[model samples]
Target: MLKNRFNIAASLLAIILSVGFIGAPIGPNNGDPTGGRPTNGRPTDDGPNPKQTIALGDRREIFADRFLIREMKGARLVMHPPRDEGPVMHFDQPWESNAPAYITILKDGDTYRAYYRGGHQRANGKKEDNTCYAESRDGIHWEKPNLGLIEANGSKNNNIILEESPLTHNFTPFLDNNPSAPQNQRFKAIGGTNKTGLLPFASANGKDWKKMQEKAVINEGLLDSQNVAFWSESEQMYVCYFRTWTGGNDRGYRSVSRATSPDFLHWSKPVEMTFGDRPYEHIYTQQTSPYFRAPHIYVAIGSRFVPHRQIATLDQLNELKVDPGQHKGLSEPFLMTSRGGNVYDRTFMEAFIRPAMGLNHWSARTNYPSLNIVPVGDGEMSLYVNQDYAQPTGHLRRYSMRLDGFSSINAPYEGGAVKTKTLTFTGKALEINYSTSAIGEVRIALQDENGKDLPGFSLLDSEQLVGNEVARTVTWNGKTDLSAWAGKPVQLHIYLKDADLYSIRFK
Candidate 1:
């Protein structure tokens, strides 16, 4: 790696970047730091209001992608923590060491499956390090079935998914949801090194695999991170996000690059993922996956690596048996969201998952989030994290977030409001996933295209909503039915006082 001027600037940005403040304006007004005004049309005594009417089905809309927020006052995006579910899988085999770090979790139909690079033993004794697999009925408990698929050294009596390829370094795969995808290629993966670039792999049952081609699809950066790819239903194409360099020694500093392919084989030239007005930080694994409930919303809950920024004391490291070479840095899960493009909306720069209250968590390479966030139970979702990396205690742990709860439009007790862009929907009632303090309340109002309050749907008619709920139907004038305005263009004026609105949708 060579240090350049841009690398120097990025290094400074990374060093100065705080978990809470990521070059965003979270000051008194609590408004859009980029100054985004109402998108449709400003409310005036004489203008009509419809910007572009959208049909909102049972889709759960979130603040993560800014698809709904047109203008907000005294409300900002908030990050939610993933509740730890403890370590569910381990690398205990002689072939499988504690170095099985880069893990991927996915919910396949009803079966939850996980894949990871589980060996560093090519230099030790094994023929090659291999990609391993684990399965679960529910995501909480895991079992590594003896797949008998690939032979790592001599025996096929292991959970190894793939072996004898450079792809095992950091193999990342996705369950293909593309309707036109071939049955045998239901599971697709991308992994390799800059020496050979990123190669594509496909599997019929996610166990037996075949290389799509000998040539690498992308060869821009040092593909050391867990390079992830998936069939994008939202864009009707295949999108891949992988590692890159900004400016540094030869490879530069850690950054992200994106490319798209109409077909899985051909891809556009790689482009760097940009964050608007935000300083750059090293993103270790950009585990970009589509939200299960709302397919349009893509979330990147990846490991934010801050190099050489040590926080653990010498005694603490010694007590936990931390690696002295890796102790100078720390990492945490940070979130970045996208609709479908090269840009990531880094609205919140805070650690999505912090180090646990212990000495082991303060070391480097821990807290790296897994590839996918899958639905674990009814109305609940789970994501796996690799913790205590490179230690004897290293294993994959689970964490959870509410459905559509990655970020929210929150209001303080002083009160704030969110006005949606003009939208048209065909639903009977408006429902919200929200929570409020006892004294807090939320009210909803339907507005005409001109931004005037629609009759019988004004804020005054809206019943005061007070409670914590995953789903609460908004009522107005003792009526919860919104069928009268169904299939028409309207805007939502939501007033919140000491409340957090996680998501909204209609039935």
Candidate 2:
């Protein structure tokens, strides 16, 4: 169990509230004039209603705002390789670090099924093509089942998925933003890519798998048929967004190629969607198109340099522009900053997000320019991500909020308590200005008018600590999709019982 145990500090005794000062510019001729254009009827329009107002400090404050530190208590890297104790799997040798692709979860009555790719670097010059499976009763804790499934290497490849040679085709197994796909409902993952050509394969039960076709999906064509499919009911197709490079240049054309099938077989032709800077995006780079899953949107992970790794939804993807280089309504894309760690190759193999913790506690990563999102977990919904600082070794870490004291408009900073005052918010996102000496867990909570807990509102992402509270700001990314806490009086509550919290501001 990956647990975070800490001690609580003594409770504060008194509560205080203080008013935030905002400055309004005093116009001329209101009382004592400086530039009061000699008006006739005793000064016109009350001196133009003061020009602007400046904020002295925060206009509003959150009281009793606690952070609920839900540590990924039992969620650890299930398939991290190069371990000295485990049965040394041949593929995981020279184990610098193992990158994880997508971890999919399936629910069968009371039991749950999981499948994930255990990715490592290509040691001994092996062409990096190995995918495996594991299981758990509760999603958090997992174990490899002794099932005599998937085999490697053969003349035509018998028990293997697919061989990534000049002879066969391979696709990175990246899950499409299809909510209705079997893979989303626990089918096998079959596509995604690395820094090179396409590598594609499929699985039945996620463990016992086989290659779909002996030949590559795209035979030396402009497009590489990587496994980037998403289930679309409107089109009734399993659409895969693939990348096509031309002349081995730094740029390539990106298209959402569709392979339609009633089942996972017997496909249709590819449909192309080119948006953004195709050449720049295709230059040893891979990216996913933007699709709406209601409040949240999904983006794919790839990089031209640094061996192309994974990244989560650090920022909202810009609205897709149908015309490339048109300078339309598209916002600038947010560049993923690599979080440093040593579990994998520092210079290579980065971690990106697959999806939010859904049926199980499985998340994903990539390595060796390899791609594939596998199912993971048995019964948990815990997921952890690392910052891309590109360090090679140490604890794969995440930053969290640290709680401090609170002040109010009615009371001063007597202790850590707040002199209860009602607050109104009319913004989209909330900001938490906090400081931490170290990285740890910090939880936040919210309540309604009747003081009922709002369902499905929690901060599960990494907390990137900037510096001291007075200098840096720790923000809680938008967990709730509502435009703002409008029309509803959402009393903010935070729990730093397990950690520390500074201050919170509603955006």
Candidate 3:
């Protein structure tokens, strides 16, 4: 009888091996090693299975992408618009009277520096664009300091920094934070047109500037708009995002291209950025840069241009005193995020900064945001936009948002839950930047890779988190420390009731 049983088992094993089911488990409980259902009370569906565990070592993950999300019910990622704080600085200077395009703001130490292209029709009947400078003790109020570096309008008493043609048309600069960067090249800038390629400039103090090289370092694209370059801390190299046409030289839709360089001089071949499955649209200027709070994520507040989609009629354009040749198109700001690659995640297709309640904002090339979003006040960050473009009323306006408030996972009053993908984190506590209604709250549960709630970290043990804070620690049964589960594969099940979870980090 024993020999007969052994023969039957051997035959079954052979059949299983032939069918390639040797160690494969089958059924609804396959996700769990113990042949039990997930503790989250939901059967595993044929959705995206958890791949390799993400090693998020105390990094703050924002809700700008669906990277770490597994499943969500009654909740979604929502983009938040910045609050318009009105015009902060006017382009009323003689050199900046016509229009001020390609604005870039950098907060260096205690002073905020503003750089932009200022141009006005010269007496010779030619439009001469110059790179101008301004400084502000507070981001709210700006003053043009007469740097007297470059002579403009027959005077060196202007705030003109560079008067070189083509280069000053869209001069964009950033403070180099790379440790290996030379002291003289502390502030690096890129500017030029397609005719001249893209030129590189450097400065020891941002006030004094010189060409890093006599010739253009990058020469492969249209390079008409603001060609922005900065030392990427996450990539440990210099990255540049510049303007390019999809069909080639000013033929197809205006898009963006990216290139990298080890030394800012030698650049790799440019690669056009792809917006997955998104319909082709004119991306006039992609103000792509690393977010200050989270350097790993590149935030782009680009201008979406619709040629001939004129919102302001001729009469309205005349009423707003828009320039004669600039009234054909309409442009508005849009939000896009990326994770250090050629792909941009357009999670929110809506306008980031909608046209305000005025015809001046509806004019052509209006509502173009500046390059960087800088922090202004406590838990507040500000983004500057060029409103009333190609008009005498053109100025840089400030818009504010809560820190890390670009997008959030919002849940209604009926309540909802979100589950994160399997991840291993380092840290003793989990902190979140969130806001909730008076009667609303948020709760969190730590679960194993199989979605089984870990002991002492279940939803029932989670204390209700209520109120608004930029960073609030989550606790379970009045305990905040989670060091015991550090470096272990786990998932986060978050329950929310009319709350907005902006960002979360384990630290």
TM-score per candidate, chains pooled? 0.86, 0.35, 0.89
Model 3 regions more than 4 Å off: 1-49, 121-126, 247-251
User: Over the stretch 105-137, how does candidate 1's per-residue lDDT look in tens digits?
Assistant: 888888988888876455455446579888999
Candidate with top TM-score is: 3
User: What is the C-alpha lDDT profile of model 3 across 1-507, one tens digit per residue?
Assistant: 779656744643353344332233344322211133231222232113456687888889888867677666656678899998989998888888556889999999888999998876666888888888999988999999978777667777888888778888899999999999889988999989988999899999898889988899999988888898988988999999988878534568899999999999999999999876566789999999989988888999999998868877888888878888899888999998877768777767889988988788887898989999999989999999999898988899999999999999887876666778899999999999999999888888899998888998976677778999999999987999999999999999887778999999999
Ranking by TM-score: 3, 1, 2
Candidate with the greatest lDDT versus the true structure: 3
lDDT of each: 0.77, 0.30, 0.84
Winner on lDDT between 1 and 3 is 3
Backbone N/Cα/C clashes per model: 10, 64, 0
In candidate 2, what residue range of length 10 has the lowest lDDT sum? 337-346
TM-score of 1: 0.86
Report the Cα lDDT for residue 139, model 1. Answer: 89
